[model samples]
Target chain A: MTTSVNPLWRFRGVAGTAWFAMVYLYLPILILIVLSFNANKVATIWSGFSLQWYSVVLDNPNIMRAAKNSLIIASCATVVSTVFATLAALAMSGPTFRGQSVINAMLGLPLLAPEIVTAVASLLFFLAIGMELGLLSVLVAHVVFCIPFAYMPIRARLEGMDPRYKEAASDLYATPWATFWRITLPLLMPGVVSGAMLAFIISLDDFVITFFVAGAGATTLPVYIFGMIRMGITPEVNAISAMMLLVSILFVILSWLVGRVKQ
Target chain B: MLSASVRRTGLLAPTVITLFVFMVLPMGLMAWMSFLEPGTYGGVQWGHYSAKSYIQFLYEWDLDDQLVLNTDYVGIFLRSFLLAGGATLATLLIGFPTALYIALKDEKARNRWILLISIPFWTNLLVRTFAWMLLLRNGGLAEQFLSSIGLVKEELNILYTPTAVAIGLVYSFLPFMILPIYTSLEKMDWKLVEAAFDLGANRWMAFRRVILPLAMPGIVAGCMLVLIPALGSYFIPELLGGGKSLMIGNLIQNQFGASRNWPFGAALSFALLTVVMVTMIAYNLRFKRAPGADK
Candidate 1:
């Protein structure tokens, strides 16, 4: 907005600092990806480029099982949370009700609460209920944690939408269900998809909650990576991490694109 | 056609119920258990309620059965606060300029830069911390590069130090700092800045008086986002500090894990929750007083 030709306006130092910050933020991830392909068993040194670690990760049953578990949990949690969040978004955005702010605050509580509290609370709750601390508990916890993430975007989308479309459908004698299915759902699809993608990423990358609530044989990839790192670093760990990072990056991009579609 | 309450209930019931059972109930249970005694083993003892766990946070029983003030847990809390605070400051220094730079860019470039900032955030935190480990270890890339450049005469063995933990925390939470500030800057009305300059205010004075105050909400939000999580983070310190550095998160985790002191763990957790709740309330009150500050 400032079109002045002042000498002070051409400061290049801030640009350089920004670039440096970006590099600092990204260099570790780039290094990890590069190290995952290094032939050396040692993580820090680069003997040469090789794909052996990727193969090693593939052959390892434990890593594969953890990946499978993460996938299942993320998928299930994303689906359930997205559905419920869509319903909630629809409800909250449709009517101006008393106590709506209270409901909104409750929805956001999990996001604001510290992860350790949520983790320990879920752990104790499972113990108190005599429920097995396995994939089911993990799934339930993930759904609860992810609903706020899914709710925000969907609610934003709903609020942005014009109410006239639904009114027109109703004036044409369309039932409420038909009006929803034909009018609302289609418009809300982009937000739903994006929110679900965000939730899936959160569920997939979760460590603290999974570490607390996971029983034997319920290790998610992040939890597995934590255990492996404690033991020692290895190229195989790097390989698995690289794969996880790739998946997460893909989902983030997809979410971004879906979010842009609403505009 | 449905009643307003019925419609509201129908839409919100599923999420509310799920969150209640999983989120609210667990918190309530944790609060309740914090008052009870820890069983000999891992779980809580049912009927014996006491404030011993809460008191134990400040005092410990010696062999002679006298309670003495314990500073070890207090030290851990202070250290956690210091680390989180340091990281938040570091992010502010680095992120403010970065957000400003992005805001000054063209719209397409701004979006790309914003996306780039988020990529690292979306990546698994464990993996990112592991990458830091690989970099900071002896003879690792960071050391090798620094030594090669004659920046250090000795090996860079910062992996297990408090410095490393701070670095990891900063790296982990930097994006949270950047995104909010960028949002504020991007939404900012540059006309006010132009007006300030036209009114004969110098650039520094304009930035100091006008830009900074307008960006306060984002700065506050970013600080909270980075500071709260950094305070409670366990893995960064555990991995980078190599068990030498202990924070409140590690303390709570130990009680729940190996220490098997459930009541003490619950009490520590409640302490953490109390801190977070206070921060949130402060933020809420601030926002309420200055509505549209964030937008």
Candidate 2:
């Protein structure tokens, strides 16, 4: 109903509840971020702020190595999945074809299936084929897993686009290749970039799939953080986590901006 | 330069092939492995096929080799479902109002609020769950605050309990619930609501007649998103449940890791997959039938 005529009795309560929910979602993360700078080694206690934990995390060779590995895997997965997903999205957004729904389902399956099932199945698949489980295997699995994330944005962008641009290019006697490269590709850049960024973030933040498929020396940051937590909690973990949160937030913002630009 | 058919083939083949090789094949292998016997170690035995794993899900072999009805594993499944259901309900209660609040806000304010929700969604779930552990453990901030406020007299020890697991879960999935319901509410025709009010319907009756049906698709979607993931979640239970409470996810992980029973783990995974797939298909059908549902 109109806000003027019949003010909903629950309006104030709903607004208050919403604010509370937001605080509830963010408070723990805010706590972690603050504690990362705490001078005390203990996680729960609040002492004077210091940059020691951040420095310590930076100096830790194992963490640095794991971070490097994560970068490599995420970059590779992002590029590979973005390419595959773009192509698939392009085809999917084009003329309707027979068995299109089946193809759609296949593309959507990775997202729909539980991560554990995919992780375990990937592990078993690798072992069955006698493939060594390491960075390479993790990369392949990540690319496959990240396809849906990459595809969704690109598909959305394509679907949002007018078909007239492509038709205009072709009507002018431009080759399909030239039309795609000059007309379609440039227009699709925002979607491709956003899709790649999303894929990178998904690959970077992934733990369950990476944990299952990763062998010794193949640990990503999340898996490494899991190991550290399993050993015991410390401020170092907080520092790294805070760092990760910053990066993920940055990527998300970048992707959001890219999507906004397309509009 | 390329024909349409060729262009389509060239574009789509790589993803199809990749998905087939990695996604479909692995699932097929897991299905095949479920019927096979476990090796002495972790891998499956090639030719020793049996229905043992499926039977083991419901019946355990005793010392006397008797087929005993095993309620233990069934209990674990039920517990997982109950916890997931609880988490879904909790998130819905919180998220419905949050989504409605956001939907009612101005465009600029709505975007900022939505961004706030997305930040947590993108944050590493393990880190978030760890923060919960830090808060919920004995003598932690939660306990200190509660006691300081006279809400409780003793230290909080919710860290390793099922309640802690539920809290972690609802926290993890609240955004999934919020975003979808917000989409529905934001796009809804408020004029209909006003018309109902003008036609002599009370606020509750107006909402029941106009708003709830419009929001049902989003509610259903949000419920599925939260529930399915919660059911299969291993980390929350592992971290918050103190490795004591076991869900089907943990059970499946154990079958592969500690138990070294590949067949059994595959069976458990396949079962979970079946349940999820059915839910997804039902969701897709229902979503398709609903007008203005998210594509």
Proportion of native contacts found in each model? 0.72, 0.72
lDDT minimum window of 10 residues, candidate 2 chain A = A1-10
lDDT of candidate 2 over A1-263, digit per residue (tens) = 22433455345578888988998998898888888899987787888989999999999999999999999999999999999999999999988998788889898888888899998999999999999989999999999989989999899889888889999998999988899899999999888888898899889989989999998969999999999888878889889988998888887887778668766
Residue B235 of candidate 2: its Cα lDDT? Answer: 90
User: Could you give the DockQ of candidate 1?
Assistant: 0.71
At residue A137, candidate 1 shows an lDDT of: 93
> Which pairs clash in model 2?
none
- Indicate the residue-level lDDT of B44 in model 1: 85
TM-score of chain B of each: 0.96, 0.97
DockQ per model, Cα: 0.71, 0.67
Model 1 CA deviation exceeding 4 Å by range: A1-12, A257-263
